[model samples]
Target: MVGVLVATHGRLAEEFLNSAAMLVGEKEQMSSVCVLPGQSPEEFLELAEKKVEELDTGDGVLALVDIAGGTPNNTMFRLSMTHKIRILTGVNLPMVMYCVMERSDEMTMEELIEALLENGRNEISEFGKR
Candidate 1:
């Protein structure tokens, strides 16, 4: 299974992991990193890299961030140069759930990336009448 890493500002990543666990039971090879107030980008990057290293077990890691241009995303981008991981921004509950429930050890990196994007997109919709 592809390892999942949720990185975001404040406690958002932690909260998302908690919620995902509640919805789909506990997940293995999954972790979260939060960039707290006054925390430097380098600090966040170091923490995130540790988590990624811990979670990764041959199968690559998947990182989800709250914002595209925020500290977490930027740090992830920098780390991507040296790690075998993919970062997805604008992470939501559905996206987390999809990744947790759908990913498997047999799936390739490209397939996992496509599935994450497809499921995340499909989860969004206009509930009210058009």
Candidate 2:
């Protein structure tokens, strides 16, 4: 299974993981890192690297962040250069759920990343519109 790492500002990453667990039950090979206020980039990088190493099992990892160009996203981008991982921004419940449900040994990292992008995009809709 491809490991999943969620890094976001404040408690978003933790809460998002909790919510995903509530919907799909507990997930294996998944972890989260919360970037708190006043935290330095070096601190965040250290935590992220640790999580990636812990989750990675030679199948690579998927790093999800809340927003593109944000600290979390930027840190993940840098980390990706040194690790076998892919970074996905704009993370939401649907994206997390899709990762949890679709991740497996049979799925290649490229395939999983493509499916996640497609699923995350297709899930977005404007409510009360027809």
Candidate 3:
């Protein structure tokens, strides 16, 4: 199985996971970490590492950050170089949902990433008549 980590500048990461979990029902498919409330990079990384470890099963890990160049993204980047981990930033609800919903025995991490990118790029129109 592919391990997942979600990190953001605030509690958004944690909150998003919580709500998603609530809606989708709890499963150990992915793990998430947050860098919020003035937590240090080391702490955030530690949390992320723990989450990764919790979800890791010899398969490689993947990280999703809320924004690029931010603390979470930078930390994931630094960690990725030393480990066989894939990091993707600029996370959104659709991306998260896509990742979780697409988790399956038939999907590889690479395929999942591609699906995530495709889903992330989709545009929605909310101005239609209600």
Candidate 4:
């Protein structure tokens, strides 16, 4: 199965996973990293790498970060050089739920990323209209 990693500043990463678990039960090959205020970039990168390794199950890993230019996203972008991983930004509850439900060994990383990119947008609107 493909692993899903949630890395974000503060506790957003942990909460996103927790919320998904509450709705979908516990999921395997999923991990979360909360980058604290005082955490060094090197330290954060190290922990992130460990999580990526733990989550990888031959299908490669998908990293869902809070934002594009943020630490979590940037670290994964850098790590992608040495690992088989894809990174996506603009994480939300809907995306987290999709990750929990759709992630699987049968799904290619490119397919997953494309689906999320498209689905993630459709999931949002003016609070009334599509």
TM-score of each model, paired residue for residue: 0.94, 0.95, 0.86, 0.93
**lDDT of each candidate versus the true structure:** 0.88, 0.89, 0.76, 0.89
lDDT comparing candidate 3 with the true structure: 0.76
Reference-based TM-score, model 3: 0.86
Candidate 2 ranges with C-alpha deviation above 4 Å: none
The 10-residue segment of model 1 with minimum total lDDT is 96-105
Which has the higher lDDT value, candidate number 1 or candidate number 4?
4
lDDT of 4 by residue, 1-130 (tens): 7788989999999999899999986678889987899999999999999999999978888899998999999999989999998898988888888877876668888888998888899888888555
Ranking by lDDT: 2, 4, 1, 3
Model 2 lDDT, full chain set: 0.89
Give candidate 4 misplaced runs (Cα > 4 Å).
Answer: none
Q: How far does residue 86 in candidate 3 sit from its true spot (Å)?
A: 0.8
- lDDT at residue 57 of model 1 (Cα atoms): 92
lDDT of 3 by residue, 1-130 (tens): 7777778877888777887777765446577777877688888788777777677676667788888899888887887776657888777777777666767766788987888777877734466759
Total clashes in model 1, counting residue pairs 3 or more apart in sequence or in different chains: 1
Clash statistics: count for each candidate: 1, 0, 0, 0
Residue 73, model 4: Cα distance from true site in angstroms:
0.9
User: Could you tell me the C-alpha RMSD of candidate 4 in Å?
Assistant: 1.4
Candidate 2 C-alpha lDDT tens digits along 45-97? 99999999999999988999999999989998898899988899999888888
